[model samples]
Target chain A: MTTTRTPKPATAPKLDPKSRGQGWGHYPLFALAFVGLALFVLPLLGLVVRAPLTKLGALFTTPALLEALRLSLVVSLAAVTLSLILGLPCAWVLARYRFPGRGLVRALLTLPMVLPPVVAGVALLATFGRRGLFGPAIEWLGVDLAFSTTGAVLAATFVAAPFLILSCEAALENVDPRLEAAAATLGASRLRILWTVTLPTIRPSLLAGLSLCWARALGEFGATITFAGNFQGRTQTMPLAVYETLQSDHDGALLLSLILLAVSLTILIALRGELRR
Target chain B: MTLRADLHLTLGEFTLDLAFSAPEGEVLAVVGQNGAGKSTVLAAIAGLIPLQRGEIVLDGHLLERVATGIRLPPQARRVGVLFQGLALFEHLSALDNVAYGLRARGLDKRSARARAHTWLERFGIDELAQRRPRELSGGQAQRVALARALICEPQALLLDEPLVALDAQTRLEVREVLRETLGAFAGVSLLVTHELDDAVALADHLLVLDAGKLAQEGSPEQVIRAPATAHLRAMLSARRTGSTPDPGT
Candidate 1:
């Protein structure tokens, strides 16, 4: 009763082993690949290979360290929540609709992700800085964004939202709109279709995106520093804290980096489990 | 339960101008070659595709003239479509998929699940309610789709080749279930297909579309005996491949 017949023929693209006179080119490329993978992986292995086993106790007990870690979690989690609330719809628009300036909007969103994090910091400072366009109006309301915890969240969100937006959009794009159409024919309105049919179908992508956005926000440093000036226990997140520790407490900095990496990896694995078919 | 449509639409390289009616409880099979506008007719009627001119009336409601146009969105139309792929949500269980329409209509989760269970039971797929689309056999998927669509109690059902994806062995069984389901439907049904066997199995009225135009519309025996056009005669030939004069040429 199984459908064992008519297996699909896969077209695997390959180069013939016997025909090459490109040994010189092949060797360099092979060597480079070996070096590249090692370069990519060696540092991560080095973290475990060279840990300050004895000083780990002090690193965890520091009040400043705990506060920074707490701030990092709060800001990054908020950033991810906001990203889902906002970016999911934005992703839908980018994925499903065609309009003028769509390509431009997509590219600009990538700016925070691709540009040097420090340069993104400068960009954010210019836009939301005290003397920036919205700064005067913002200050007049007795609300100070610069050098504040909210500033860290805003800064993280600026860079992190793009990750969720792109990932969720791609997931939404892959969902067959036919299913949504099918739902519509069943007496549902557009909004109803989105909430009930469309959202469930694209849930994995949204989850994946938020996880990535949270990871990105957690690792955010330059934008947080520039937009919200690092102040320990106030705006200094784990990354900012790590930067401060780098000068005087190298072991502590490494410990914080390791924790961040471990947490992000766990999140990614959990997210993948959620998204799997 | 009756459905009426007068539609004209232009999509990229093709145009569709169709006027048709399916009385309550009748199953109308739309037979056409590729790009013959059969799918376009369904999309237009479902309000998925924009129409340059036309209106659709479903069970006495002027569906085409609302602010959104006689083309109320696919959701508001309450017309069920068994898309060619069956397009089940890959992530959801069969029960959840069947409950999709009820939820979209804003039913409470409890009521939706109950209705979905009723639908699955009717389709005889209740045992497979927890299975995802990928886990179901082709016939099972089709049944799930049918159940999902029927649960809404749509005024009309539009099926786009419900059996095309099935292997030969499975298609016969699925076709039989589809036959029974169509017979049981209290509303109008329209099945779009290129296969004569499929059209004949579930539909009483047949439409032959050639190049975005309706070449002929009648019962299957009538079409088989006296095809309206030579192109249609060639199409009617059992072989999947055959040549016909281009309608434009």
Candidate 2:
């Protein structure tokens, strides 16, 4: 069928933009975009291209590799769980409710996400260290977090919790406050309304936040290593494992890097697909 | 279900200092312009906003004195509100949306679902139970909103710009449904509307609000007979259209 809505091409503008009297030519914007995209993909492409294909299966199945992978999953999941426990409510306060110095609190929350991972590690060490102010007292209560698996989880959490909080805050901000009002008028207590109404409305955002938090936690390098130390079967995550292997077995490091990439990509794809439906 | 509110609430530059009451089964329609604090009154009564100084007595009990914040967190207030957009949960099915208040009140899941189905049936949208709010038409969503609010058997109902979200044709039909629904309700009803026809249809008492104060309050016949302000007159005049005024004067 010939569509009546088809445009008259004969009356269209000239093919040559130069002759059409438009001065537009080279775009710095496109150049900048291309450079940014190249920077993003270059390291990943290098790792894939330089992989030791002959020892790929062996590298993946090694006991040390498997242990590190398991630890990475455990710590990342723990970090994400703890972040949700703290971040969702912190985000609610930021987005919906208001109090004094709220702007300062929000800024401080985001600082962890943007600050260098090494700097975050230093900050955590200063505040929660054995010799630190609140740290010695907590340790005396038989809770030894430093250089333990739990320490790794804490480090990851400190670095990644901001991702969840910021994302969920934006989601909550976009929602109409009227719905909460409507729920209350219906005789639902505050907690009930949160679970039944507020939470579901912001699920897509919460999922996005959780996914970001998990990815950040999984790939955590500097913070985990500095706070918990790199132990092959305990505190060594996939990223830390890759770094340790790089100084000796180049092939092992590349294989482990690919593993980290695969794991994070699989998780994000699954979560995004689940939330889409 | 006689409710009385004597409030002095302030937000930014807008202030609401007014006193009013609506007897049980009475329709109190508040008419006002954009910035006339129409929504502020609803928000304060719903416990979404704070009251500076005054009391809101529902039936006979003081609702404003039990301060955790705004008396009771929205749920405990038991005042049904229909926001301008209806604010139906997009993720929830129509039946679930209607049943939400019931389930939130600790009703079992099975009973909540049954009650929701009943409300849906009452609103004549039973077949659309599984349909999410996003999939519903404007009129259907409004009906679901009505069912959602009314199912809780609230002691009082507050509706803000109920017809604003509907199409011209749908508004005409929905207004008739709202009138029927209001007639069945034994509780007090406060509907805020700019449309004269909608107010004249459902409201027994007309309250004209101007500059954060009650400009006039009287029966619809009296309010329409001599609209107090020029703004009120313009509203009635726009709909005059050669329709003769009642000569019962």
Candidate 3:
């Protein structure tokens, strides 16, 4: 025999009109968003459709393509590492401190992000090339940057460092200054507070910045070719290789293009969790 | 373990000029309405803010003196502060949060965690050691913050509205914990609170501040029996009537 219990009195659940989910009223906005999104994804879709998938295995084994892939990976990773080492302090200074010409310094630092890639390469050459400004002094120390692998890394860094700096600076700005004060009261020194509090607090943004910087460096073309010059197993990255193969071997260029696209998509997907947080 | 502060600071249209002292083993409650420079006074004592003039001395050490241009940084002053929001490190576990001071003072990781664990146990929060700050309830967070402040054995402690963020029930519970802890502490403690009940319950001496100046300073009983300023008189009457006092009045 089942026991019977009295039902408890209940009131109607409140429904907030403002909190309601999407309905017919949201359809126009949703359509516009989809259209805006399609503008970004359509080119990739086109590339995927035209790519020679059947010969992908054979294309991957091409010596020049393999060399370009390896060099691109090495140079881009180096560029990202360089960006972190140099850009983090710059970002920290910009975010936390105020001094003379701060606005001018920030604008100058971010100049390369919007400057044409070719112009950045020109600037790099003018600063570090054999006959360029400071070039003679640099060569005196037995260092050659222009038309070398080092030049490729430098060019990529010139274009990508600003992305990391901007993201990291914004992240630092978002952290509560009171937290640092708390750390100070806890007997933490300036560097200690940065390591345990400030840096950890902004870890997600740092990761986001790293991925963006790496991806930007991976896709660097105009700057690399202009300053470093495309040379197999040396300065030629995937983008430069793809550019060269476009004239002689369309299939090879398509394969290289697909590889670059795949790499960027994978990195973005991996960083989605960090970016969302 | 004594704190002597005479601060004169100017921020825009507002200027703070106040002087007070708290000897060892005493809790001096700095009571004031909002924007009355209560927090600013604490910040100056903690070395977070600079004084335009005047001096702050802790146990004969010159922490700050604008005349001599001698001001020590916060870390070197050995002051522990509990902010209004607690300001517990969100990234760290409860144990690590308590251990932060020990680690910052150059203690090894193993020993710091061990010591931190002991402080957690002292606060009856050993079970929550591995949990992050956001995971703990308000009272638990307060206990953890208190433990963190006491762990370093600071020369002076600064508490900013420690019980203001808690619920009614939790406030009573945490107050008991704080009363016991403060009673045991040998160092000077400066408690900043807006609630008159909190001041009466915790502080040995009371200081009523109005418009960046000291309006009244005495024992809790003396302040209630002989209210000096209009603000204090209003507050006493509001308390007697079981109603919250209007800060503006």
lDDT string for model 2 (B1-249, tens) is 998987678888988987899899999898988888888888888778878888788888667853434375566777888888898888789998898888878899899999899888888889999998877777788889999988889888889999874655677677777888899999999999877667888898988888789999999898888888888888777766656442223
Off by over 4 Å in 2: A1-32, A274-277, B65-73, B241-249
Sorting all predicted structures by lDDT, with the top scorer first, yields: 3, 2, 1
Report the lDDT tens digits of candidate 2 across residue range A80-151.
999999988899999988899999999999998889998877777777778766798878888877778998
Q: What TM-score, computed on C-alpha atoms, does each candidate reach?
A: 0.89, 0.88, 0.91
Chain A TM-scores in order: 0.86, 0.86, 0.88
User: Each candidate's iRMS in angstroms?
Assistant: 2.9, 9.2, 11.8
lDDT score for candidate 2 against the true structure: 0.84
* Residue A245 displacement in candidate 2 (angstroms): 1.2
Pairs that collide, model 1:
A184-B74, A184-B75, A185-B74, A185-B79, B63-B70, B64-B69, B64-B70, B65-B70
Which candidate has the top score in lDDT?
Answer: 3
Q: What tens-digit string does per-residue lDDT give for candidate 1 at B132-205?
A: 88888887888898998888888988999787756766777887898899999999999999876678767889
TM-score of predicted structure 2: 0.88
By DockQ, rank the candidates, best first: 1, 3, 2
Global local distance difference test of model 1? 0.82
Model 2, C-alpha of A196: deviation from truth (Å):
1.4
